[model samples]
Target: MKISKIKEYFSDEELEIRFKSSTNKRIRDRWHLLWLVQALNYFADDASISLGYSRSWGYYWIKQYNMKGPSVIVLPKTRNPEWLEKKVTDEMKIDLLDKLQKEPPEEIGGGLWSGPKVAHFIKVFYDLTISRNKGWNLLKECDYSITSVRPKHRKSSDEDKDHFKKKRAPKYC
Candidate 1:
C-alpha cells in the first residue's frame, strides 16, 4: 500500500509506542525484529513511515516470512571450531625456506617453486593445507622470489642452438 494510505490507517505516535515497547531489543536478531515490525505494519497499515525503513525492504521481509517462515530470517550461527587463527609459524616457515634453499633446482623438477608446488610441499612436509595463492603470499611475505637458478646449457660443436635462438628473436626489437 502507498505511504499516504499507510499514514491514513495509523498515526506516527502509535508506531513509536509499539517500537519502544517491543520486548526484543537485539538489533542483530533481524528475524524477530523484522517479523515484529512487519506484523505491526500489517496490523497498523502504516508500514511506510514505520521506523523509516524502505518499502522494498518491508516487502522483501514479508516475502521471506511467507517463503521460509520467521526462524529462517535469523542469522545462522557461525562457529570456527577448527579454524586456525594464527598463520604458519616462523620456525616452520624458516624450516621450509631452509629446505627450499638446500634442495637443488632439479630436485623440485627444475623451474621456480610454483604456488601449487609450494602449497603441496607445505602440506606434505608440515601437514598444512594452505591455498596456493596463500602459499605464494607467504613466500612473498618472506621476501622470497619464485625463481630457480639453472646452469647454462653448453652446445656441442655439431649443434646449431644459436641459429634457433636468433630465429626466435623479435624482429621489431
Candidate 2:
C-alpha cells in the first residue's frame, strides 16, 4: 500500500521525542515506522526493511493506526508470572528436593526419576498432575539431575587388536 502525505495526527517532533524516550522496543519501532512515513516520507517497504519488520507488518501497523488511535502501535509485553508456580508449588519443591538428596531412584529400586517418573511421583505424593516437561522443570528447580555409575576406561580405543581370522573345522565334514 502507498503511504500518502497524510496530515500529522502527531507532529514529527512529538513522535521523535516518544521514540527516543520509550524503553519498549515495540513502541520505538512503531514510532519509527510512522515517523519514516509522515516525517521522512519513506515508502512502506523501505520503512519495514529499515525497522526489521516484514512489509506486510508496516501496512498492518498503518491500518491499525487508521482504525484505532496512535496507542495501538505500541505492543504490550507478554506477561507470564504464575505458569510454573501454579503447576509446582513451593511445598512440592521442598519435598522433591528432600527426596533427591536421600537416595537415587535406582537405590530405592524404582529406576531413575525421569520426566514421566517425576510426573507420576508428583501425582502420587503431592497429589498434583503435571506434564512430563513440567515435572522435569520441577526437578531442575529442585537442583536435581540424572546421574549414573558406569566403569569405562577413559583412553580405550575403538579398533581391532588382531587382523587375522580364526579357522574352525566344519562339523558336517
Candidate 3:
C-alpha cells in the first residue's frame, strides 16, 4: 500500500526542539518518528524500523497526526474538577473516628466496627457509597489496626496457666 506524504506542521528546527525538550521517551520517539519521515524522507515502515517500533505503531501515530495535528503528542494540562474533589471530608473523618470508638449505631446493628459497618455508616450519614476496602483503608488511616483474641478452653484453670508460664515457657534470650 502507498503512504501519502506527511504534511509539514512544524519546521525541522521546531521538531528538533520538541524532540530534545521532551522528558518522556515515548513522546520523544514520536517526535523522532516525525523528524525521520518529514526531514529525512523516510517511509513510515522505514521510520518505524529505524526507531525500533512496529510498522502499525508508526502508521497509527501518522494517521493521528494527519487527523489531529501536532497537539496530539502534548500532555493535557488541566484536570477534571469533579475527579479532584474529595468524596470524604475532614469533618467526615472526625465523625468516623468518633463513631469507631463507640458501639455501631442502631441502623447497622451493635457489633465491632467492621468494613461493612463503616461503609453502611458512610452511606447513612454522609450520603455516599464507598467500597468495603475503602472503609478498611479509612480505619487504617485513623491508626486502627486489626486484632484477634485467642480462644480460651472451658476446662482450663488459672492455676494451669500459671504452671505453664512458670515451667513450660521458653527461656531463650
Candidate 4:
C-alpha cells in the first residue's frame, strides 16, 4: 500500500472561510479536505472519504494550493472552436427576399440561376463566394423554391419520333 499526505498552510478560520466562500462545491470540499488533514491530523485517504471526494482529489488540491492558493482550486476548462461561420445572415436573407420580389429568375439569370449564377450572386450581393450547395442551402433557408421550365435550344431538330421508328424497323420482325 502507498501512503499519501496533504500539506496544510491555512488555519481553521481561513479554511472555513474559503470553504464557505467558494462558489464551486467541489473546490469548497477540497479546502475542507486539506483543513481536515492539517488541523485534525487525519490521514489523507480518510479525509478524502469524509469529504466524499476521490483519493487523488485531496492530493491534487493540496498540490495546487501549495503551488498557488485557493484561487487555483478549480480545474482548467477548455472549449472547441466554432465549426463554421454563418454565411446566410438574417440581413442577407431579407435583402435576398426583397430583390427576389422585385425581379423574376429569367431576368436574374436569363431564365434561371444555375450553380455558377448562384456563386456570382453570392459574390456580388453578399460579398461571400460560397459553393453551389451553400447557395442552394441559403435559398432554402429563406423558403425559396426553384424549378426548371424546359429551356429551349437555338439548334433546329425534328421532333417526329414515329418517322425514325418506321425507317429503323428490322426486316425480320
TM-score versus the correct structure, for each prediction: 0.43, 0.47, 0.49, 0.39
Question: Which pairs clash in the backbone of model 1?
Answer: none
Question: Cα miss at 68, model 1 (Å)?
Answer: 15
lDDT of 4 by residue, 76-171 (tens): 322212324635677776777675554334433654444455556767766776788876766666676565466555563566544455665578
How many pairs collide in each candidate, listed in order?
0, 0, 0, 0
- The TM-score between candidate 3 and the true structure equals 0.49
lDDT of each: 0.54, 0.74, 0.82, 0.65
Q: Write the per-residue lDDT of candidate 3 for residues 1-173, one digit (tens) a residue.
A: 33647778999888888888999898899898888888887889888878999998899888888888998866432444654563878899999988877888999877678788788899998888889988888888998754547679999999988887855668899
Model 4, C-alpha of 75: deviation from truth (Å): 6.1
lDDT tens readout by residue for model 2, 78-105: 3435444546767777878777765545
lDDT of 3: 0.82
Clashes (candidate 3): 0
2 against 4, candidate with superior lDDT = 2
lDDT minimum window of 10 residues, candidate 4: 75-84
Between prediction 1 and prediction 2, the one with superior TM-score is: 2
lDDT of 2 at 156: 58
- Which candidate leads the pack in TM-score? 3
Positional deviation of 156 in candidate 4, in angstroms? 42
What is the C-alpha lDDT profile of model 1 across 83-118, one tens digit per residue? 554368888788777766644245345456666767
- Displacement of residue 144 (Cα, Å) in model 4 is 19
